[model samples]
Target: MNGVLFDSFQHNSWATKVLLKVCSQLSAEQLATTAVGSYGNIIATFNHIILSDARYLHHLSGNAPEWLLNRDLSNDFAVLEARADEAANNWQQFFTQPVDGEQLTILVSGDYEIHAGALIAQALHHSNIHREQICAILTSLGIEPPDIQPWAYAHETGRGRDLPSEQ
Candidate 1:
């Protein structure tokens, strides 16, 4: 019913689709490879990215941490896919209720406080940044990542184009 809520759902759904496509083609070893260097292995990197944002969500809303923060996995593919699903589900739950963007706030460790909407935006942007990293790693592994354009996911899902229709 709210515009912000709608946008959040759409963006996160697109991200989930991208993550699934990425993990689908990689072998377990390749998914766990640290060839990307300082960013950590693909599975670790993905978990880190999702967990970091979830941590912020906890800080902002006092929600409990999602499973990714504490879980260990013996299988790389399972871990990667599960983390993606967990992160998306958590985000979806958070956005299920609408709050006016202005009513949100980000608590600073010391003194500074930021707008909550800005923090949410930053978290999403952070995820997108790492998604690009994952994409790069996938490309290097000779796995073709899916076309993750928002329009593409929307159309594929029969959710229609994100762009405005022509008159």
Candidate 2:
């Protein structure tokens, strides 16, 4: 009841928030570092991911958060985390609706329309790809990023329990 049946939105937010916290500890130069295949530096990538999330959520629910309009909350971890929280709440609210995946929705102004399910899928997929990019950047820096996989989210949030191995 908190979100969609699988609630990937919450996992998406949690995983990104976890990555954001890890990135917060980096020095300025480190944060600004980007790999050959990444989307700009860590800060810029985080900005893109969070802002795009707001946009996708806005398209879905018709409620736009201030970040989508303002676009000035850059590289500020506190602000980013707060914005992520607001986005998570909005997604939770959206999931509560009687949504139909087959319904058509406008992706962007004047852009072609797509199935409602595709929009949601894109949002989750986008967040994931960028997070891995950051992880790659971190690996290049010799830093081990925290595990933000769905299983890690499940373990941290008690969504799953492990059993001991048996012979």
Candidate 3:
């Protein structure tokens, strides 16, 4: 289960990078353009993704991430990308160490107790949904969003080729 979770995190990070690469091609105005049915615009959605990941990291690590707190959504693309990279690294590091999935409890709104693994899974799913929303926004803007499928990430990272042949 830990291995699967770790792989999913890697996939999420890969997809984020691909999306950011496509976002890099757009002008500031295009990145900030409002799209219906999205959290805000491309940049705002990206910021939400980053900050949410940071919050998850804080929950997992038990240390609040000061840098991610109180951030404005209007940050430039480069800054957001850098912050995303940092958040991804934090998640990767957490997965690298031994995680007591059953022992870690996340306090939800200071009332409910939830497993850390569940929260991580929720974060992963949430990110994917937001990524799709970003893709839709990009499409509406006449820009083709980059491919962010897990298979594409596996192929790009040489993991797909690593599987044994069925022959």
- Best TM-score among the predictions, by candidate number: 2
lDDT tens per residue, model 1, 50-76: 666666566556764447346443335
Whose lDDT is greatest here? 2
Candidate 3 lDDT tens digits, 1-167: 45667778889888887898888888888877876777888888888998888887787787545666665554676877777788888888788777876765755346667677788888898899899998998888888888899888878988786668899
Each prediction's TM-score against the native?
0.72, 0.93, 0.86
- Candidate 2 vs. truth: CA RMSD? 1.8
Candidate 2's C-alpha lDDT? 0.87
Alpha carbon deviation, residue 104, candidate 1 (Å): 5.7
For model 3 the TM-score comes to: 0.86
lDDT of 3: 0.80
Clashes of 1: 0
Clashes of each: 0, 0, 0
Candidates 1 and 3: which is better by TM-score? 3
The CA lDDT at 57 in model 3 is: 71
The parts of candidate 1 lying over 4 Å away from their true place are 34-38, 66-76, 103-112, 161-167
Task: List the global CA lDDT of all models.
Answer: 0.65, 0.87, 0.80
